[model samples]
Target: MKRNILAFMAVMLMLCMSAQTSQAQLKRFSIGPYVEAGFPTGDFSTTHNPGFGVGLGADVKLIAGLTAVGSVGFDYFKGKTIDNGNTKIASAKVIPVRLGLRYQLISILYVKVEGGTANFTGDYNNGTGALVAPGLGIRLLGLDVEGKYEAWFKDGTHGFFGLKAGYNF
Candidate 1:
């Protein structure tokens, strides 16, 4: 029920942002710092729970309704206590470099998809894997709000529901 409500709210927000675009000239370029919280699912939950991410990103307008997006992000997931033993206080760290495009459906509302490799290490076996993300974005008053579902297909299938908010300049 919570996911459904969040989805509904996102749709309504896009509608509202689209309505406002008709009244003002929208910005074509933006750069900023972003932070994301991740909820683990599937096999990822076996070892790690919820986590946090930080990144820097940029958007450049290409053509009508199209923009190029790129980001470098870092995420940390703490290990879970298993068999009554604490795995190391050190958290697994993952760095991902992604590039993709955003399509503006209406005014300040857009749909985005990105894919790249995430490199992970620390307190666990080092590994690299592909990351795919599909998401929605709402830009209002120099602030950017995004919600995305991320998947890491690696040693095990890992998934996350992510929420990200940032200030864009």
Candidate 2:
């Protein structure tokens, strides 16, 4: 997990340097900090368990209607038991570093392909691995809404749908 985080940071630094060179010609480059509350929905042992998460990201408009996004986020899942009562399965802290290509479908709507590595911590028996998530987004009234299905090759697959309300600045 530590190594993955380091790698992600390194990549982010490189991207930032590149962006700096092109900043003069870019239309807009903005950063937004967001918080998200959602649950993990999957067929794994733990389902319908609620969790809260937060993230910070930057969006760099590379073209007129296209942008390059990089984000790092974390989530904590209070696991569930097989029976009715709740059990302490495990709490996961996920750091997802994604590089996405965004296309403005309309004036206030956009879709993105989110592919990144999810460095996880906690007692998730399936093991920690990377994930490739494809998602969509919409920008309206200074708020951005996004939903994506994440697939972990080893740490179990889950769908994460999030609604983020943040100012793009």
| lDDT tens per residue, model 2, 23-72 | 74653666677777665556632554666678777777777788887777
lDDT of each: 0.76, 0.67
lDDT of 2 at 144: 83
Given candidate 2, what's the lDDT at residue 14? 69
As a whole number from 0 to 100, the lDDT of residue 127 in candidate 1 is 77
TM-score of each: 0.77, 0.77
Tell me the spans in candidate 2 whose CA falls farther than 4 Å from its real position.
Answer: 3-7, 10-27, 45-48, 84-87, 140-142
Tens-place lDDT digits, model 1, residues 62-144 = 78989877777788888787756855345668887777899989989989999877777665637788889999989787788
Give the winner by lDDT. Answer: 1
Model 1, residue 159: displacement in angstroms? 1.4
TM-score of 1: 0.77
Off by over 4 Å in 1: 1-27, 84-90
